[model samples]
Target: MKALVFDKSGLDNLRVREVPTPLLGPHDVLVKVKLAGVNPIDYAVVQLIPVQPMPHIPGAEVYGEVEDVGEHVKGVKKGDRVVVYNRLFDGSCDICLSGREMVCRNGGIMSVVTNGGFAEYMAVPEKNLVKVDLPPELSASLPVAALTSYHALKEAEVKPLDYVVVFGASGNTGAFAIQLAKKMGARVIAVSSKPWVAEFSDHVVGYDQVQDKVREITMGRMADVVINSVGNAVWESSLKVLGVGGRLVFFGGLTGSQVNLDLSTVYGKHQKIIGTTGGTRKELLELTELCKDCRVRVWRILPLEQGREALEWVAKGKDGRIFLKP
Candidate 1:
């Protein structure tokens, strides 16, 4: 099988070459890749995450069809079109049994902890796959971005009439945040580049004018729920504009991970600083249902061979999500 494999961690190290197909296990399913979502984290996986063996394939979210199923697999079968949950866990663990599989101590993201779907074929655990009635394009992008945004909103406990501000709204997860917040009847303030804006957001502001515009729109109330993925870049501004008793959810660190935190402000304002990773399998299912026919704009689509170039482009930043068609 032809795949984008990296013997070392870096974009320059990535190469498309022939590799042996993955063998299926009794509790695993073999999927023939269709469309795979290329996240900035994919580059991190290739560059930073350590794997015992060399030649790692880095595609975190995949939408594919079942080429084969393991003997122990049930509730799904051959030829089933599915989405990979991307997180693997030991089912007997305390967190897994409590249904918070996203944070399972024994689990890690598929592409980072193991070889992911940057190839023609890959094998995944049966429990990590979810069936979705979606087109191949949506099947790829929605699993990660939509799932993460949905879970973040759920975690923030957004309610109707709440003022939701999404930083990096033009990016993958942020775009979904705009749509989902609006769908749930919240007034959405999207902070993005001047030329970029999603049709669903109630208000749009560029990074330069985020705080001012948000204050104007909310009449000094500021944001009730603020979702931020960009780290230090939006850190101060997000905190400045958040209303009293507000919530700020942090998941991605696309800008830079390290940042300064003010304990006094947090306590005085009674604000909540929530951190989340990926979405649960249950939330992925719900996200798919809510996103049915929902318009999600793709920045670009490249073939598997262009994986290296795709990583480079993603690094420079983009108006929306990018995916790989395998």
Candidate 2:
């Protein structure tokens, strides 16, 4: 099997190499990889994180077909199309029992701490796989981005008629956040530095306002809910745009995480700050259904062999997801 292996050195440490197929357990499913979603963490694992052993495959979200399944796996069978919930959690953990497996204490992320999806074959726990009716036209890129965005909005508890502002709306997670927030009946205010991003929305480029033009549109009111994925670059601005008692959902810190914040605003405004990661299996399933119904649009696909290229493009901060077809 051909897999992408990362060493702590740098890009030179990344290479396509032959590796043995993963061994499966009774409660696991062997998936023939079709597409692997390239995330920032993929590159981070290669450059920043300590090498897992000597070689590690870095990928989290994967969409593919089930080649075989363990006897205990009832949700899917051979030839079934599926999406995986990247969080690997112990079923007995307190968080898992309460259906909050994303925060499971004992579970570790597959690619980060274990073998991930960037390979010809990978074995995953049956509970982590969500069976979906894969549409021929819908590629892997859509599900991964949509699922993450869906989960982020769900965590924020976005409501109808709410003023929802999404920072970095052109990026993978932000794009989905914009559409999902709009679908939920919230008046979406998508913030992005990209000039053409607003074309995706029915509301034109100056239809509402750009990030710099926000003050004119909001008239000093601020948004009711702000979905921020850009880390330090927009953290202060995002915080400044929140109305009193509003909520802010933090998903990723793409630029840099460290930031200085004024504590008085949080206490004085009674605002809420929520942190979220990946989505649940059920949420991924719902996201797939939405895509199948043509409610969501997936924009791009790239082969797994070109994983490095995909990672580079994402690092450039492009809009939409880049799927690696394994």
Candidate 3:
């Protein structure tokens, strides 16, 4: 098998080369990669995090065919088309039992904890696979990007007519945020430096103009909910634009992580600052339904050998989900 492997965590270290195929565990499924979704976090993990076993493959989102399945596997088998959930958790945990497995105490992500789908084949636990009914190209982009936005919107408890602000609106999860928030009946305010607009959003503005436009649109009431995946670059502005008693659901640290929060301002406005990570299996299942209906959009598809270049595009903050075909 040919895979892009990095002996260590650095952009320069990633290389596409022939490697041994992964052997499946008794309860695992070996998927022949059809499309692998490249996300910003893939770059973060490759360039910032440390992992064991010298060489590593770094792709978390996958749309593939089950080339083989263990005897214990159910719901899906060989030749079944599916998407890998990417989050692994102990089934016995309280959170897992509640179906919010992403927050389990024993949780770890696919690319971060084990080998991933950057290659021609990936072996993952049967529990982490979800059957899908969409083309591999479109299905590739939904696993991580759509699920993250879905999880955030659900966690925020967005109500009909609530004003929602989405930072990085042109990015993968941000784009999905726009649509999902609107579907939940919230009026979406999309922020991006690029020229992008969604029919679902009520307004679109640049970062420099977010505070003013949001205030003008809401008659100074500001946003009822703010989803900030871009991190510190817009952190202060995101906070300032929130209405009193607002909820801010933050997930990524794309720009920079550290931000100084004013406690007085927070309490004065009765604000809620919540943090989220990769979504649970339950949320991913919902996204799979959306995929079947062709509700999500993928920017483009490239070959698996272009994994390095795709990572570069993600690091540079491309406009939407980039898919890679093996």
Candidate 4:
């Protein structure tokens, strides 16, 4: 099988090369890759995450068809269209039993700790596959961005008529945040560089004008929740927009991770800062249903051979999703 594999710790090290097809265990399913979502985190996986034993394949979001299944795979069979649940977990663990498999102590993320689906064929456990009714393109786009956005909003406890401000509102997770907030009955204030977010948000403002716009829209009460998926670049601004006792939910940190937190302001305002990453398998299923009719902008769909270029395009910060057609 041909795949985008990186042998060392740099984007420059990534290349398309022939590798052995993954052998399935008794409980694994072999998937023929159809479309794999390209995330900025893929680069981070290659550059920082300790992808053990070298020659690592780094694709975190996958949508594909089951070409074959291990003997023990009971729920799905050959020819099933599915999306990969990128988190690895032992189903019998306490965390898994409690439905918080995303943070299982014994589990790790796909593409980071194990080889992922940027290839012609990949083998995953049966529990990690979710059958979907959407097209390959849309299904491929959801596993990372949409799932993360949906979980963050749930964690923030957004309510009807609440004021929700989303930083990076035009980016991957941010775009989903805008639509999901409105869907949940919140008045969304989108802070973004592009005007396209205006289609879904109650108010759209640039980062420079976000504070004032949020204040005006909420009539000085400020935002009930702020979703800052952009990270350190918008940390201070995200905090500034939240009303007293408001919740601030953050997931990815595309703009560097380090940030200065003011202890006094947090204590005095009684603010809650919540941190989350990928969501549970249950949330992923729920998100797919909610976004079934949604169509996201696809900037490009390149062949698997152009994996390096796709990652470069993602690094340049485009406004739409990118996918690899294997």
Candidate 5:
């Protein structure tokens, strides 16, 4: 099997090499990766996360077909089309029991702790796979990115007619955030520096306004909820644009993580700062339904061997999700 291996040295150390195929556990499913989703974290992890072992395959989300299922697996079988939740959790953990599995203290993300989706095949826990009937119109390209957006919106408690501001609106997560916010009946304000994003702003239905600058668009009154995928660079401004009692959901730190947040306004304005990670099985299911119904549009697709190229694009802050077809 061909896999892109990452080590402590950085992406320069990444190599395309033959590797042994994964062996399945009793409760695992063996998936033939049709497509894998690359996140900014993939790049960051290469630099920041210490290499656990040589030849680490770093991918978190995958859209694939089940090639084989363990005897203990009941929900899916061979030939099933599925989307996987990258965050693997111990079923008995308190967080898992309470349905907040993504935050399970004992179980973190797949790419960070275990072999991930960027390969010809991956063995994942059966509980983490969500079987869906893939729609002809919906390709594997956008599922993970869409699911991330869906998770952020649900966590932020976005309400109809609420003023929602999405920073980095041109990027994959931001693009979906814009569309999802609109679907939830929120008046969206999308911010992006790239001129090409104008196409998205023009076509996507719910954005009330699109701008290169945040302050100019807000016109003094901030949004009720601000969805930020770009960290540090927009952190201060993101908080600045939030109205009193507004919610700010942070999903990624693409820019950098160190930001000086003013704790004063948080108390005085009754503002809430929330952090969200991956989506739950229920959210993924709902997202699948939405995509199937033509409520969400997939952005684009790339091949799995283009993993390095995709990471480079993400590092440069390219617009839209880049799918890696295995």
Candidate 6:
């Protein structure tokens, strides 16, 4: 099998090379990779994270066909179309039992801890596979991008007629945040310069205009929830748009991680600042149903061999989603 591999922690080290096919565990399923979604975290893993083993394959979002099923696998059979859950968890863990499997104490993420779907094939536990009705290209992105936004919105507890502002509204997670907020009955204020953002959001404005526009639209009440997936670049602005008692939800730091916060502002406004990571499997399942007809812009689809280039695009903050075809 040929896979995109990095023997060290650097984007420059990534390359496509022949490797042994994965051997399945008794409860594992071998998936023939069809499309692997490229995300910013893939770049982060290459540059920062210390992944085990000398050589590592870094792709967390997978859309593939079941090539083979292990002896104990029963839910899916050969030729079944599936999307990888991407988050590896043990069902017996305290967090898993409490329905927060995304943070399972005994678990680690795919691609980071285990070799992921950046190859001709990948072997994952049967529990990590979800059968999908959508096309492989589209479903490939849901596990990470859409699920993250969905989880953030849920955390914010958005309500009908609530004003919801999404920073980086044109990006993958941001676009999904706009659509999902609308679906949840909240009026969406998308903060981006892109015209496509208007298709999903009730209102669209550039970052420079977010504060003034949000104030006008909400009639001075401000936003009930602010989704700031873009990180510190817009952190202060995101906080500025939120009304008293509002929730500020965040999951990514694409621009920069560090930020200065005035503690008095949060307490005075009764605001809640929450941080989230990968969503639970339960939420992913719900997202599959809610967003089955979802449409995402595919910026490019390159062959698996061009994995390095795809990572570069993600790191550079390109528009639309990028996929790797294997």
**Whole-model lDDT values for every prediction:** 0.86, 0.75, 0.85, 0.89, 0.75, 0.89
Which ranking of candidates, highest TM-score first? 6, 4, 1, 3, 2, 5
Give the CA lDDT, 0 to 100, for residue 225 in model 4: 96
lDDT of 3 by residue, 256-297 (tens): 899999999999999999998878787888877754544445
Pairs that collide in candidate 2 are: 304-325
Q: How many residue pairs clash (N, CA or C atoms closer than 3 angstroms) in each of the candidate models, in the order given?
A: 0, 1, 0, 0, 0, 0
Q: Write the per-residue lDDT of candidate 2 for residues 77-162, one digit (tens) a residue.
A: 89998777788788788888888777788987778778888888888899888777766334454445676778888888999988
Number of clashing residue pairs, candidate 6 = 0
Worst 10 residues of 6 by lDDT: 45-54
> 280-309 in candidate 5: lDDT tens per residue?
878877877676543323445666566778
How well does model 6 score by local distance difference test?
0.89
Cα lDDT tens digits, model 6, 68-161, are 9889899999999988998888899888999888889999999889888899999999999888889766699789989999999998898999
Q: Could you report the Cα RMSD, in angstroms, for every candidate shown?
A: 1.2, 2.7, 1.5, 1.1, 3.4, 1.0
TM-score of each: 0.97, 0.90, 0.95, 0.97, 0.88, 0.98
Quote model 3's TM-score. Answer: 0.95
Candidate 4 accuracy as TM-score: 0.97
How does candidate 1 fare on TM-score? 0.97
Tens-place lDDT per residue, model 4, 25-127, is 9999999999999998887887676875577999999999999989888999999999999999987889889998988889999888899899999999999
Q: Please report the TM-score between candidate 5 and the true structure.
A: 0.88
Q: Largest lDDT belongs to which candidate?
A: 6
Candidate 1, residues 137-222: lDDT per residue as tens digits? 77787778888888999899999999999998887788888898888889999888744565778888888877888999999999
